[model samples]
Target: MKNDDYSDVVMAALHVLEESGSLPNIERENKCEKRSDKYREEGNIAFKVGDVNRVLEFYNRALMFAPKNSRAIQLAYSNRSAILFKMGQFRACLIDVETCCKLGCPTDIESKLIKRKNEATVRSEMENLSANLLTGYFKDCFKFDFKSNTPIRCASSDIEVMKGDAFKVVAAKDIKVGTPLALEDSFVSSNSEKNVPFSCHYCHKMSEPDTM
Candidate 1:
């Protein structure tokens, strides 16, 4: 059957199940389980072939069909987390790992999941630290102090903002251009032009460059 047709059928079935306001039909539940498993298996195949994009796609589809609060859903989330980690998407991977934990990973794989979660968390933290440091450095170059207590207050009243907030630099009193607003220290900083021969390009950390 066409993909659209199959989706319509599934949606209709889900609508019927919802309107019933009772336990899902065992047969229908089992079918969803089977389909989820099939997609997961396909994801495994894609992983073996090193097709990262395909693996992620299959796992996502598996998640869509997997029943809520089911082991299959948790497993799918866990599997997807691994792929996200490989892609260097530590924050996204951490989110998936958290979801797996909330859903209760299978006992046999719980330890493995926990390990992945820890790694993802550490990586996410490190990345965040690096980002903050970079941001601080750039702001400092412009002499902008983000932490300074100014008359301007950042508030959020709109849902359109991603963090559900907006920054409003309102002036309750006269402000000067050279006024020190806030002070922040970068996690790591270096003079690139002076340290190029002895620093890492990415982090600007001092390092020995090969003379080859």
Candidate 2:
């Protein structure tokens, strides 16, 4: 039978069986278990070939079809969390990891999953910290303090403007020419310059004269 025609025929036959109440009592648990594993295997194959979209689709279907509180459900969540972490969706990955853990993830892989959870948690927290830094009362002056923002750090108190995406920054007071708004130094220091003729390469500091 042609594939398209077969679908319609099967759908009609199944619908009629359902309506007539003649559909045999299939073991739903076994059926769901089999189908979920089948889909998860297909997703794994697609993932191996780097077919990201197809992998996600199959894994999602597996998750939807998986029986509640079943090993299949835990495995599907664990597999999808791997994909989410690879995709840099840390928050989504964390949710899946938590669910898998609650469902009693396989002992063989649980340690690895826990490690992944910790790394993703750190990245998620850093993302939140950055967003908070750039918001609210810190909005205008948020970009000023940087232990490492150099490439540049804002230095002018009169100026309320930030560099990256800010537009109108009117100086609250008259600005002098050559006033430093931001300054950043390269990570490198050298002894080649006259100021430091001989400096340690490690710390870039010149040696002191011998007192003895």
Which candidate ranks first by TM-score, i.e. highest?
1
Model 2, range 115-156, lDDT digits (tens) per residue? 999999999899888878768656655344423232224344
Q: What overall lDDT goes with each candidate model?
A: 0.72, 0.75
Q: Model 2, which residues run further than 4 Å from truth?
A: 1-31, 136-212
Best candidate, lDDT: 2
Model 2 weakest lDDT span, ten residues long: 145-154
**Number of colliding residue pairs in each model:** 2, 0
RMSD of 2: 21.2
Cα-based TM-score, every candidate:
0.52, 0.50
